[model samples]
Target: MKPRFTALLTLLVVALLGGCASQPPLRQAKDVDLARYMGTWYVIGHVPYFAEKGDVATADEYRLKPDGDIAVTYHYRKGFDAPEKTWAGKAWLPDPADTAHWKVQLVWPLRSDYVIVDLAPDYRSVLIGLPSRKLMWIMARERQLPAAEYQRLLAVAKAEGFPVDQVRKVPQRCEDLGQAGFEQP
Candidate 1:
């Protein structure tokens, strides 16, 4: 009994210390203009969740609802030649004052964090992140970001404590453009 208690206490101490050493609270971009943010944003870079494996030419379309919830349609192709597919979800602000932090529900019951970590002044580009920076999406108005802008976003993500090395460049082809759901008039 004495040995077991000693071992358990040692583990507890290590856990507490580890928590203290963990990364600081993630910083988010302030004052997001929701209307300006609504549109089709092409995914140029991402730290994909398992479901996104082999995804190509990915994009997300957001439509602001009267009740302030965002209707999201995620479009992607499994491969370069595969047909485009879509998934739907909704995102809502947990605190009305904090527009940058959203609780996105992609499936029933479970909600995930969606933080606007960075956004271009022109609204042409943006970066959204999940908790622990384990997932992130670098999106822009076009299929790909310019080299300079991409590098700038990479630096911003790194400064924000994301694992930059884990980011995968999402493939986008000009031929994939103008798909019905991915393109908005």
Candidate 2:
């Protein structure tokens, strides 16, 4: 009877864990004009991660390289006078079928999902997320998003099963950078 009980408990645990797994076949934007999408995007909000916690004035710059790959640079400041942190990497479309889908390789042998799940018609804003819906970023062309627009984006994220409560606003004060030289592509 003890053995049978142990077997039942094992099955129950497996079932419970399975339910916590992410839903499959994650959706991505239908199509993306990589050219229009390439530019400086201020990180207005994001699902907090260890590396980005307490970060402010965060932004991402994307450049289309001659080889068709994208050069990515992430910038952020930990505090008011903290030295800025930068991470440079490359991203590419592994599947030619989907330009909206990209894999970013910031560290060797480890590629992260860079799916464009939602994008503004004029390319002013975009919602990037991973398949697991565990990580997400709400990026925009400028520093701030209107309250209504932000709410709409949050609703869209919630529909996608993201833990919206984990989303935190990122500080973006270009003046803190002491330079307004970055140009949009």
Candidate 3:
């Protein structure tokens, strides 16, 4: 009886693990010029994590370091009058063959996948996705994206198997920027 129970438990564990790992591998952009990709990008929309929920005027700044790693700074405010928040991190190419696929280390020893799934020809907009397709961010060079462009990005994300309805738009009010001392890009 004991042996039978142990075998059943092992089978259950294997099943659970397989289910958790069933997500398809994310596809990354064919070629990304890391130099052109570096700069400030406004977060127009995202499937928010706990830390970024309710955040407004969200933006990410990237700088290429001498060591080849990318320095990252995430900036946002909770509300129009709320205090500004900033989180610093670093990103590096895990596979030398693919510059579009990166591992972002926001905290020590805890890295997350940062794949560039889509990029505009002019480098004015980008769509970033995770391997699980659970997290996504649509960012643009300007603080606000045109309505048509915004909808187009949403469609692309939806087609990629992401929950597009859950993607909340980040508020980029002029008043919010004036207080934060950020000029329009």
Candidate 4:
């Protein structure tokens, strides 16, 4: 298998097996307006996945498909000067009534729950997590968040059953690239 494929598979498996300790049930965000959530969200912090290891300028973009599924794009770089690596995936609401719960698939026949644990009313901030608390992401519309705001998001994740101590802040200091030229295979 190619290194990228190995990394992606490892990510899905680790997210499922990471948090083995028994814990309280994870809660979904009260509401998620898919329309407002569609855009590039900078990954300010996260419990790093294999694909994201040593990566910087990480972000996820969501586009609504006509079928009500989401067209997902993941962008990352190995270093400040590294050309960006991009990939396409798909996400869909398993239950229409539960908009916060999503089944995301990057590789065929392998899907993981991408729950919206918390979302700001203004759509500027969001917390995405797994039911097992194994993985978590703190994202915002802006690449950099105020110190206080970042801390607040961490607190929220902790309250929501995440292992905040394991969270790593993703570096967003890379120079702006008008368009990334590489795609993951």
**Residues 101-146 of candidate 1: C-alpha lDDT, one tens digit per residue:** 8877655545667789899999999988765666678899998789
* lDDT tens readout by residue for model 2, 83-111: 98777778999997799888776554456
Evaluate residue 32 in candidate 4 and report its C-alpha lDDT on the 0 to 100 scale.
84
Give RMSD to native, each candidate. 11.3, 11.7, 10.7, 5.5
* CA-lDDT, candidates in order: 0.76, 0.74, 0.76, 0.80
Q: What is the TM-score of each candidate against the true structure?
A: 0.80, 0.80, 0.80, 0.87
Off by over 4 Å in 3: 1-21, 174-185
Model 3 vs. true fold: TM: 0.80
Ten contiguous residues minimizing lDDT sum, candidate 4: 176-185
lDDT, candidate 3, 1-185, per-residue tens: 34334334433433333235356766677789999999999998888665565678889999999999999988877676778877777999988789898877655545667889888888999999876777789999999888788888888888888788788777788554433323222
Cα deviation in Å at residue 51, candidate 2? 0.8
Among the numbered candidates, top lDDT falls to 4
By lDDT, the better pick of 1 and 4 is 4
Residue pairs clashing, model 4: none
Question: Cα deviation of 48 in candidate 2 (Å)?
Answer: 0.2
Q: Clashing residue pairs in candidate 3, if any? A: none
Instruction: Provide the lowest-lDDT 10-residue window in model 2.
Output: 176-185
lDDT value, residue 12 of candidate 1: 45
